[model samples]
Target: MIINTTHHNTEHKQIIADLIGSPFSLLQKFKMKGVGSKRMIIDKVSPNMQSMMNKVSDINYANIELRPKGILVMINQGLKNFTWIIPYYQLTIYKVNGSSLHAQGRFVHFKNNKTFKENKKFFDKLLDEKVRYDMLFAMPQGI
Candidate 1:
């Protein structure tokens, strides 16, 4: 399934994926957080560009979008079971390096071209970086 052709569209959208593990299977979870996650069809870029780009760490993501409600994830499938929506706040992007992302204690890496800057422009419209990004990307210091 990993080798399937990427579905591209002129429509702006960002799909988050990991190169380390099988990111395609992210919709299914081994453990439930109790909050309950939903699957929706999403194919739009984030309105707040800086809100997402500020979390960048050198490596680029397959796609990462910030929606009005939460983080909208894109899935390559039929209309019935397509997208996975994870609350933006619940998704704690703690660490991002190489092609890997440590979000909410789960390791997720990019499975597509990782040219961070170029990819960002290709996905979303870039806004200024003056916005306060501390609270969003902040992780627990230690136990």
Candidate 2:
């Protein structure tokens, strides 16, 4: 999702992309039947993400959106310690598999990349909605 090239921060963008790319995303998909939505304070991170976060500032969570009592993520528009807000007008989001987004950075690979590949429908549903991507926050670097 290359939106604004004017300000670029590769590591920061990778962190946000990694979050979306990580199996953590599926944690929301198979949410317990009636569990309520709450803020996400992700302290323990995957090895891949931890390695990536090390290159940036101290990680934390923030609710940039005005959604009350909803889950929040720690990211900014390619900056340290900011909430990520996807710019729908300029960027297109995709779900790709593997440890991170595809090298080309268009499609998101989700096959065999989730905590539970047992459910193929979840996988298909993710890809099927490419046209209606969730407003994933796109963080441009060099802020």
Candidate 3:
């Protein structure tokens, strides 16, 4: 899944539309299971999935031609036989010339029925000094 801090807008929507037009691609659907909030689910209907996809679609569409800038904090793991159980997180900041103005969020390598909170502490710590410092320090001055 793709994640970005930018608000979902028209430009981003176009990018998603293009990706959806491609073959052998699937879009994730967000559904509300309870009163808490909505969560993403894999959708089998191709066109419908593409049409409904948001967030990531918006991010990619908006910055389709932009080169990656700033620092990207990525957490990845390789699970041998059980590849699906691996958990990964990536946060990317897209810069405009000299300053960061866009960001994307991602989570992958999750197994079926897996829960994020199971690794919340680890994820939180990464978001804290470890990941935060890395991103901030890696950026060029004025970015």
lDDT of model number 2? 0.33
Which lDDT tens digits does candidate 1 get at residues 1-143? 11222445332233333312223233332221111222211212234222222232432223444333344433333222223344444444322332332334343443333244334432222111112233556677889
Candidate 3: lDDT over CA atoms?
Answer: 0.26
Better of 1 and 2 by TM-score: 1
lDDT accuracy of residue 24 in candidate 3: 19
TM-score of 1: 0.31
Off by over 4 Å in 1: 1-62, 77-81, 99-107, 111-117, 120-143
| Candidate 2 TM-score to native | 0.24
Q: Quote each prediction's TM-score.
A: 0.31, 0.24, 0.21
Q: Pick the TM-score winner.
A: 1
**In model 2, what lDDT does residue 104 have?**
28
The clash count for each model shown is 3, 15, 4
**Order of models, best TM-score first:** 1, 2, 3
Model 1: pairs clashing at backbone N, Cα or C within 3 Å: 15-63, 18-109, 19-109
How would you encode candidate 2's per-residue C-alpha lDDT over 1-143 as one tens digit per residue?
Answer: 22332356787555544443322334554552222222222333334334323355653322222111121133322354433323323223233332122222222222232232333443244333333444344456695
Q: Order the numbered candidates by lDDT, best leading.
A: 2, 1, 3
